[model samples]
Structures are given as structure tokens and as C-alpha cells.
Target chain A: MSGMSDKEDEKKSTKKDEAEIVEENGLVYVDYVGRTKEDGEIFDLTLEDVAKEEGIYNDEESYKPMLVAIGKNWLLPALEEELVGMEVGESKTVEVPPEDAAGPRDPDKIKLVSKRQLQKQGVSPRKGARVEVGRQKGIITNVLGRRVRVDFNSPLAGKTLVFDVTVKGIVSGEIDKINAVIKRRIPGLPEDKYDARIEGGTVFIELPKESRYIENVQYAEIGIARDTLKVIEEAEEVKIVITYERPEELKEEKETQEDEENEE
Target chain B: MSGMSDKEDEKKSTKKDEAEIVEENGLVYVDYVGRTKEDGEIFDLTLEDVAKEEGIYNDEESYKPMLVAIGKNWLLPALEEELVGMEVGESKTVEVPPEDAAGPRDPDKIKLVSKRQLQKQGVSPRKGARVEVGRQKGIITNVLGRRVRVDFNSPLAGKTLVFDVTVKGIVSGEIDKINAVIKRRIPGLPEDKYDARIEGGTVFIELPKESRYIENVQYAEIGIARDTLKVIEEAEEVKIVITYERPEELKEEKETQEDEENEE
Candidate 1:
């Protein structure tokens, strides 16, 4: 970005003098702890040590400052709305009503099924077992002698949520922001794995070797391009490169086979 | 390419004067009609109308001149080997032995199974019903009340094959040749859907919109890049772009929602 002209348009209603503030469509990294209002029970958080203490640590999850695109609903709508106008390193506590979060629990979504029918659908008729009916993931709350009750509402529904959130950083600059956008779409790999550059209005991305055989990467490619174009105004195009290079060992492995086939 | 220096390296044992001839790793297009030597049965051919006349038309196949990467085994090993050193418009009839085509029929491949066992494997015990056992596809030869006979050998394993092949053209020039490689990997889409270009040492591809939701496009991306690098020789890198643009209708649909969320 060339000095004055670029920053002026990106700035909107800045409360502090010469400080980057959050705005709609801005990419920001945040650390947050979400809890239910009824019991103040921590359900989700970004700190690994805290999760370990709370007995909610998952081996597969990478605990990092969550990246959120404001106005995109990556967070609860109420929480995201409160993030606007906040500056980097700012901390705030926000209360979200059930409507703005997971929505009020719908009694109509609950159903009772015959035990035989549940068994026929391959669902074990045991209490607390997870089940999916009509594409809704539900919990089998009760298993009577001949009938089972399932609740399809989301676990957090109908409960107000409270969050303690800190804006760690607001992503700036073209390429850094593009990398952030890429990390949002393809989260399996670290940001350092991808080499990104901008030249002649086109953004070039070199994907890491591990992504070459990943299934359905075309969706990630489309999402990356769309999100980059929507957030990074100057990026005219996004190009991703996935390379499969033969290592020296593989070259040696094919030599005997090459010697055997002179025609083909 | 620096004209004279490059052509001298690519040319290998050319038979004709100033005419580009096929060599090892060259890309060529061919039209062929494959027949069984036992009864001269028309089994496969590239021409669609001929397939219809012979009562073997298949709606799923795209009947175009077959693109073969010489020495890559896209065809039978003997057939691909014969493609080397051939020039455009040359026609030849080649006879292939059973061993070279599909391997000699194995006597041990014939097996008898109970009809109940075939039914358990979800195979109908009718004569000529296709069945797959232990990853080998076979056809049922006889069904006797409770006993069934299946031949695990390939249908053409014991027969000599004849192919009337004509070399239609050799794919030359970097861009045209790169498209061919792309088509070879992502066969479901047309070549024109991807706009490919080479700048500096990198090859850039713009994938079609329909490919975004395909189940396993990463495999194709890797295959295309590897094949291009191995066959094209000049490409040092490959970059692919997939774009998802919001149409005017979708933009109009979101305006009301945008107006409602000013904080986000």
C-alpha cells in the first residue's frame, strides 16, 4: 500500500488517533473464552493450557488465536457486532442472547421413534448415544422399553452465552491478509507452508506438498479466491500452485523399470 | 525457447526431412479400431458412429481422437511402443499376442461356487452375470441349481488383438501440449474450460467453475503438474486458479441483510 491514499479508505470511524480499528469485513485474530450464562461453564476457548485444566482438551485441535472475519458470522452475530470499532489489544466482555447465537431451541425438532425403527436405521437404542435423523444430529435422551426420544436442537440452543474476548491483532498489508484468508479456507496446513506473492495484480500461492492428494481441494481453491477478492480489494486474481516433484529416491526406483521398457 | 538450440535437443532420430516425427515421451493423437483376432469382433474404436453401427454405443464416452503420451503406457505397452517413431497421417495394422495384451489366460482362475455364496456376495447366479471376487472382475459361465461357475480371467485374456491405428497429429508447442496434459488428468472437463499460460518458469491454470465441487480434484491437480513437468520439460512450476464470483442476483439478495447489520 502506498502511504496516504490506501489507509484513508480502509479507515472508518476510528476512535483513536492513527490506530487500526476493526471494521466490517476486516480480518482479525482474537482470543476468546465462551461460557454458558446459566452455569458459567466454559464450553469453548482458545487457550490450550486452560482447556487441559478444564478437561476439554482435544488432541486433534490446534489452539491458536482464532482468526475471524468481521461481518461474516464466524463468531456469534452479537459477539461479532460488538467487535466492531474495537482496536487491537482491546479486551471486552460481551453478552449474547440466545436469538443472536444458536437461536432458541425449537420444541418441534424433538421426535420419538420406535426402538425397532431406530435399530433398523442402524442407531443403537441407548440413552446418550448420538444419532442423526433427517440430517439433524441429535442425542438420544431416553430409551424406553419400546420407544426412544431424540432431541435435534443444537446443544447450546436456548441458552444465553457470555464471552471474554481480546482482539489480538488486525491483519493488515496485502500479502499477509491474503495468507490469513488462505488459512481460513485451508486450515489443515500452517500459514508458513504456503508461499504467497503478489505481482501484476495477481496473487500467486504455492501450496505445500501435502495438499497435492487431499480430496476436494477445488472447494478450498474457490473459497480462497472468493474471500481474497472480497476482502483484499486490490487483488484482481488468485492463483494456487500444487506441485508433485519426484525425489531423488523415487528417480532411482524407476530406473530399472525404465530399462525394461524401451518401446513404452 | 531459443529456436535452434532448443529444437536440436528435442529432435531425436528423426526419419523425415524438416518434418516433426514422434520420439520417446512425445505427445500424439491417434484414431484406432481394436478387434479380437479370434472372431474379428469389433470391441473398441474411437469413432462414435461406427460404435453405433456395431451396436456398442455408450452415451458416457466422449469419442474423440485418443490422445496418447508415447511411452507412458496410456495404451497397451506394445501399442504405445509402436507409437514411438511414427509420424502424422501414418496408418498401420499391428497384431498383439495374448501375453502382451492382457496376459495369457490362467487355468486356475476358474472357480465353482455355491449359488447361495454368490447371492451373499450380491451377485446374481445367472449365466453371463458379471461378478467381482477378491478384487478381480469375472463373469458367470454356468449356474446349476446350487452350484455356479465363474471365470476370474479377463474376457480378452486368451485372445490375440488387432488394432488398425492412424496417427492423427503430434501435439507441439508448449501451451497446446500443456492443455493436452491437463485434459489427460482432468478428463471430465473440456480443454477450453481451463485457460493456461506460462510466464517466467511457472505454468498458470485457471480451472473451470464446475470443477469446484468435484470430490477429489487435488489428485488431478497433482497429476497435471507432474505430467506437465515430466513431459513438457520447460515448466518449472504450475499454478492453478479457481474463481467464484457472486452474480448480480446474489448481490441484490444480500443488500437488505447488509443494511440490518451495521455494527458487524
Candidate 2:
């Protein structure tokens, strides 16, 4: 009887693994760390401790899992390809060449621009300053007496990238997919601030009182709706709900004052 | 016959003056210059040349006549009282006592706060910088070693103010009043960005495409609606219309490409 039970448990585990394998056009959540191939210097990471140890932790930002739609070109082509068939709890290191990454740097993209031109546009030219010079956006590589050298190449160009990607989990369920899309579009929001419910192919998002006046909230809503419809095939409508309330402290003080008045 | 016509014209002009006289609760527009009574130094002015001569010309801000709803406490009580019964295109100089203006400056309002406290609160205490310390808003008057002096008193307090006011025109008509309220709430918007039209009791405002995504536009809309109801008794509804468009340069380029394709 023990041997028969062990065989049945192994069969169930294999079935679960098959179900969790990443597929084309599947929505996946991942925690990733990106490093330069040459020196292995960490450029980006979603893990909090790894980011802090790399001296890039920002208290203002909340590190969370990133949502990726496979085969949609949301990520580097090579990286996305490698991520395919990755099961939940799987980790992989993908090496991407310069061309497959941000492309190789071109010397011809560097040009000399007059400092006065930048000043006229209210941009102060300084060495290592990122600025918009004419029609091209570039970083000021050098600032001279009357001219500045602006390099329009991508900062990570000419360098191969190595990404250590871990599939945290596969986001399944229509509601979870909606939440994942919202998380991707409007990241750094606390999980409790919004609640998502789906009924009859419609998604209703309840927004916290404090989030109604957030900057670019309308854009974020539109982005969430677009991405939700793209990922969740059953969702046909997305509605954002905002309920107004006085600030918490003010409301509490008012309630206390009213209680005192009633007692008197 | 010429003498008879001239006498009749004189009577007509007097009647016109009586009709155009400013009244209590009347909406009026004015162009004014505020100067220090002690030195006749211009402190503020709507006239470009006067502002230029005073070395206070700001190229970024648009200078235009200010709108006033008399008896609304929008202006200093003394100044508003003096403006009553003035005629259109008339100019007046009103001297307002300190008590009726910003009120007397209180020395007790000035206090020294530690620079470290300000820094800890992420407030940079620069000399002449306006900052909010605790619950009171104040200006930094001095920065000493380890301490900064903040004065909560108004900058114009303890001094009589002199205003050279000229009534540019009296605002009449429901449409004009609505426009004035919008201008008052959102000053410096170019005149062509929005067009307001009234139909029945509803006001339809066509907003520029660029303004639809502007920050605090919702708050501005609420303010305009509130002020319109207060000023224009006939208006009952304010509707904002937003239209989207491709950028002009991109649209033009697309059209040129289409033209080439059609030629082929």
C-alpha cells in the first residue's frame, strides 16, 4: 500500500509540472536580476536584498514581481525565448549579445552641439547630464567652453547582458490576471489599495480614497484596461470605482468631536 | 443745426456714463499697478512697460487685466469700496491702510527653528525661501549657523499699500461672465485654447486636446463650475469637451507619405 501511494503522488507531481510550464502567449510573473556580462555588475533586480546590496535600493520604490506576456515582444526577444517552457519555481540564466540587447554603439551617433542652443531651450549643459539636444535625446558626454559632446546611443549599448530570471509563479485565474496587469501598469501601489472583481466578463476595480487624485491615474486605468483585455480573454469591460472620503485623521477627529458633543 | 446736434451728443454721453458706472456686486475687469506708498516703487503691475521699468518683467507669465466681482471680498475692502461708482476707462489711486489690507505685522509670529529639523523634514531652508513649517506657512528670513529664522507674517503687512487701478471694462453678458470666471481660476491660458458656448442652461466648453491630460485639470474643472454658478445665475451646467489628435508634425508627415502613396 505504501508503494502504490508513492507512485500515485509522483504521477500527480508530474501532472502539476506539466500544467505550470510556460507556454506561448501565456501570462507569467517573474523576479529577475540583470547584470552586465563582462564584469557581472548588477544593473537591475526585482529582489529587495539583492538590489540593496548592489547599492541601488530606492525607498520610494516598491520592488515587486514583473508580469510578462510571452511572445508579445514586451521583453528582449532572446530573453523571452529562453523563458519559454520554464516551470514555476525554475531559475535560468540567459546571455544576450549586444545586438540582441540594446544594439551596438555607433560612433557616428555622437555629435557636437553648441552650449548656447541648450541654454536657449532652458537646458543647462553639464558633463554627464542627460538632455534633449535638438530632435535627438542624448547624454552630454563632455562639456567644453562653447560646445558639448552629446551621445545619442543607448547607455547600455555595445555591452552583452546576462539576466538571472526566476519564474515566481504562473498567474492563472481571471481575477489574478487582471491584478497582474494592473500591477504591471501601475506598480509600487500597496496591494491593499485596490480590489478587483470579475462578473460576467467585466472587471470592477475599487480604488482607495487616497488613490483617486494620484497623478496619471487616468492613464494608468486605460493601460490596465488595455492589458487586461489583452491577457484575460473573458474580460470585456473594465470599470474603475472611486469612493470619496475625508482624510483618515480628519475623519477620526471629527467623529471624536461628535462623540463628545453627544455625551454633553 | 450743428450746435443743436453737439448739445444732444453731450447729453447722450452723460447717459452712457451713468449706464457704465461700476456698481456693488457688479463684475468688472481692471488693469492696475501696486506700488509702495513710501517710495513710489512699483511692487506689482499689470502693465508690461511699468513691470519692465520696475525690473519685474517675467517673460513666462502673461499679463492681463484682473477680474473683480465687487462685494465678494475678492479685493481689499478699502480698494473695493473705492472702486464702486467708477466709470469704465476711468483710473483711480486708492490708499489702503495697513489695518484694512494685510493687517499689522506681529513680531511674535517670527521664530527661529533648527536647520536640522528643516533638513530632516526635507525642507531646504534657503534665505527668502517660502516654506511650510509645522502647521503654519512662512518665509525664511535669515539662515544662521545651525538655525533659520522663519516669519509667518505676510510680506505686505505693517505697511499701507497704494494701488493705481484703472477700470478696463465692466463685464456683462452671461457668456462674458463665464469666461471671466474661467480666466480667474486658470490664468495664463492662451485665449484660443478653450471656447465657451451657452445653450439653454448648459455651458459647453471645448477644451484643447493638450489640456485634457494636464495635471489638476479635474480640480480646475470643479473650481470653474463652482465659480460659474456663483457668478452666472443663469448657468446651471458646465460640460468640458476634450478632443484627441495626433501631434501636428507627425500628422503632417503621415499626410505627406499618404500623398506619395496615392501618387504611385
Question: Which portions of model 2 miss their true places by more than 4 Å?
Answer: A1-28, A35-42, A49-61, A69-73, A81-98, A104-264, B1-27, B35-43, B49-62, B81-95, B104-164, B170-188, B195-209, B212-264
In terms of lDDT, model 2 sits at: 0.73
Per-residue accuracy of model 1 over B128-239 as CA lDDT, tens digit each? 9998877888899988779988999989998999999987777777888888888877887876788888887677777876876656777777777767766655456666
Output the lDDT of residue B103, model 1.
Answer: 89
Q: Write candidate 2's Cα lDDT for B1-264 as tens digits.
A: 111234544666745744367876678887889876877777677788878877889997668777787755667768888888997768999998889988999999999999988988898889998877778989999999999999999878788899999887777767777777877776656657878887886676655645546676656655676566555545555555443333354345445645765897
lDDT, candidate 1, residue B225? 73
Worst 10 residues of 1 chain B by lDDT: B1-10
The ten-residue window of minimal lDDT in model 2 chain B covers B1-10
Report, for all candidates in order, the number of backbone clashes: 0, 0
Give the Å shift of residue A129 in candidate 1.
Answer: 18
Residue pairs with backbone atoms closer than 3 Å in model 2 (clashes): none
lDDT of 2 by residue, A1-264 (tens): 111234544666745645467875678877899999989888777899888887889897678767787755667878888988987778999999999998999999999999999999898899888888657789999988899999999888899999999877676667777777777776758777778887786676765645546677656766676676566554555555543323354345445645765897
lDDT score for residue A151 of model 2? 94
